[model samples]
Target: MIKASADALVLGAGPGALAIAAALSSENLKVEVLANSDPHEPWPYTYGIWGEEVDDLGLAHLLEHRWKNTVSFFGEGADNPSSKSNIPTPHNRDYGLFDKNKLQHHWLSQCELAKVQWHKGLAQKLDINETESRVTTEEGKTITARLVVDATGYDPVFLKSSESGPVAVQTCYGIVAKFNKPPIAENQFILMDYRCDHLSEKEKSEPPTFLYAMDMGEGSFFLEETSLGLAPPVSIETLRTRLELRLANKDIRITKLEHEELGLFLPMNLPIPDLKQPVLGFGGAAGMVHPASGYMVGGMLRRAPGLAKAIAKKIRDSEASPAQIAQCGWAELWPEDLIRKQALYKFGLEKLMRFSEPQLREFFKGFFDLPSSQWYGFLTNTLTIKELVSAMWKMFVKAPWSVRIGLMGMQGREIKLLWEFMKPKIKN
Candidate 1:
C-alpha cells in the first residue's frame, strides 16, 4: 500500500527525528515519522549537558537534576583528598540531567498538536528521483516525500561507513541502584574520578580508567566505570567487573535495581551528503556527536530547528526543482565552517588515542590545569579554532615529558588518518 505523500519523511522516532519533525510541522509542512519501535518508548541511556545548551533549547524546565560544579581527579590516591590532583569546575560551569519521560512527552505532544503523522515499521529502501524521494517499509508500504531525512542513530542504513574507520571509542557499563546511603555527595557530580581504590594491583595496572558518578537524588546514584577511548573498545565484561569492584570498595550495597546501561560510541567523521541526492543525515550518522565526549543530544537539539527552517524556506521560496531544494538542506547542514569544526574535533580524538596509561594521567593533569575557558570549551564542543590552538599550545607547555613523548610517537596509520581529516580544511 502506498500512503499519503508528505513534504518531508523523517526516519527514526528518537529525539533527533522528533525534534525536526515537530519543527517542520510547526512551519505548516507535512511531515511524517517512521520508526521501528513504539514511539513512546523511553530512552535508556542518561545524558549530561551544559546549562547553556538547555537554555538554548528552551528545555531548562525538563531538567531532572542539576549541579553547580563538576569535579575530576587524577593519579594515585585520587579518592583521598591529600594525595591527588583535582579539578573543580569554574563557578560558571553548571550541568544537568534531563527527565527523559517528561522531555519525550513534551516533544511527542508538540508533534501531535502539529499534526505530524507516525508509522510503526522498519524503513527498508530509499529511491531518489528528480522530483521526490520514495521510501519503502518492511510492511510493504511506500512513502514519497520532497525530502528524506535520516536520524537513525549510530549506524544508519542510509549512510555509507567511513573508510578511515573509527578514530576511537568511549565505552562503559553502569547500573542505577538504590543505596542505603548516597555513595556520592548530594550536590556534586563526579565527572572523572581516576583514583585506584578497590582494584588489585594487577587490575590497577591494566588500563587507565575512571568512575562517573552522579547523585540521582532520593538515596540513589548512577555510577559507572568508563574507559574514555580505545581502538578496539574496552569489553563490556571488563567495564562491569571494574564497576563492581569500585562499588564494593566503597561498601555501597545496592538495595534494589532500577536499571542498567551500556554506553558505547565509536567516534568518526562522516562524509557530507551528496547534494545530488534527495537525502539528508542528522544526529550520529551525520557526525553530530562530539568526538571527545561522545555527547550528541545537545548538539542535535541545537541543530534540528535551524535545519528545519532552512528546508522549509527552500520549499517556500526557491521555486527551484525538488533536487535543488534538497541541495539547500544539505548545504545548510554541512556548511564550510561546520566542516572545519568537525575536522578539528576529529584530530583531537586521534591525538587522545595515542596516550598510554601513565601518559593519560599526565594528559588529564595538564587538561585540568589549562584555563577554565579552554578546557570547558573543549568539553562542550564550543571551542573556536583560535581557542583550540591556544588550548593545545597551553597543554603542550604543561604536559609532562612522558605525555610529550607520546605525542611525538604518533605512528604512520594515525598520521594518515589525521591528514585525511584535515585535507578539506587545508584546501579551504
Candidate 2:
C-alpha cells in the first residue's frame, strides 16, 4: 500500500538529509524524510567548521566554541613534545565547533516550520520509472515521489557509484574530558600537532598521525589523534594509544572523561555518482566529501539551498522528465569544473599517502607557506581549475628539494588522472 507521497523524499536522518529536506520544503515543495533513526536526536559526533563557513550559512549562533586563531606544530623537536623550541605556524582563519544539540534542533525546527513530513523506516527497495520513484520500506510501507534524494551518507544503500575500487580514508579517535591542567591554549585551536615524542622510535617509523585539539571552557578539552588520509585506515586502537601517550608526554592528565568519540572513519576518496541515475545523491553519497580534507558537512550546508531550488524548479515543470529532474540535482552538486578540481585533489591525496614523515612535514611546510587565499581556497574546495593549478605550481616552487622531487616523480600519474577527468563525457 502507498503510505505517503511527496514532491521529494530524502533518505537518511543525518544533517545532510534534514538540511535538504528543510530547504526543499521552504521552496514550497512537499518534502518527506525517511530514516531508521529518530531525526530529532542529537548527532553523536562533534562537527568542526571554519568560522566563515558557518557565518556564510547563517548558522553561526549554533557554535559551541570558536577560536580566533588556529595553529599547527610540525614536530620540530620531537625529542621533547612540550618544548618551546618547536614553533607553531598560525592560520589566520577562525575555527568553530558545532553544538550538535543546538544544530540538530535548529534544522529540525526549520523542517517543522515548513511542514516537512518524516517517516521512521529503513528503505528496503527502490524502484524508479518515468513519472515517479517508489521506495518500499522494511515494514511493508510504500512511498512515492517525483524525485528521490539519497543523503544516507558514505555507505548509502540506494545510491551506488559507477566506479569501484579500494578507497582511502581519514580516521581519528577523540575524547572530550576535563583535564587537571589545560591541554591547549584556550584562545587557540591546534589543527595539527605532529610531534611524536611520546612514541618509541620504532613506532615513529610507522604511518604518521597528528593531534587535533581544542580547549573547551572551564578545564574541559576535546583532543583527537588523526590520520589525514590513509588506505587500510589507521586503527582506532592505534590512535587511542598514541593520544594517551601524547598527553602523558605533555604532562596532561584527564580528571574526568566527559565524552569519548570511539572513532571517526570517513572515506576521503570515493567516485562521484553517475549522473545518469534516476535518483539523486546528496552529501557523502554524492562524493561531496573533499578528497583531500574529508570535509562534507559545510559543503552540504552551503549547497542545500541551490540544490533545493534546482529540484523545485524542475518539479514545477509538468513537462520535465524524471531523469531531467534527477540530472538537475546531480549536476547542481557536481558540475564539470568541480569534477576536474576533485580529480586534482585526489591526485594530491595519492601523493600524500606516499610521503614519509619527514617528507610529509616538508610538504605541509610549503603548503601552509602558500598565500592564505591559495591554501584556504584549496582546503575549502573553492578554487577553480586554473587557480588550483596555479596553487600547485607555487607549492611546487616553494617545496624543499626532496619534497619537490617526490612530487615530480608522481607527475605521470597526476597527468593521467587529470586527463581522464578533463575529457568530455559521452552521453549514453
Each model's lDDT comes to 0.74, 0.85
- The clash numbers for all candidates, in the given order, read 0, 0
TM accuracy, model 2: 0.95
Candidate 1 lDDT (Cα, 0 to 1): 0.74
What does candidate 1's lDDT look like per residue over 1-428, in tens digits? 23328888888877777777777787788888999987799887777787877987789988999888577667655465554344343335678998988778877888899888898889999887666778899899898887788878767767554345544678888888898667777777888877676777788667667888888877778888888766777888898888877778777788998988866554544444343455777777666777677787787777777888988988775344456766787787777656666666766666666665667767887887887778877877778767876898888877888887776676635566456445643211
lDDT of 2 by residue, 211-270 (tens): 999988877888999997888899999999999988898788999999999999889988
Candidate 1, after superposition: displacement of residue 389 in Å?
1.8
* Stretches of model 2 off by over 4 angstroms after superposition: 1-4, 78-85, 411-416, 424-428
Q: Which structure among the candidates has the greatest lDDT?
A: 2
Show where candidate 1 strays beyond 4 Å.
Answer: 1-4, 78-81, 85-92, 262-277, 317-322, 417-422, 425-428
TM-scores of the candidates in the order shown? 0.90, 0.95
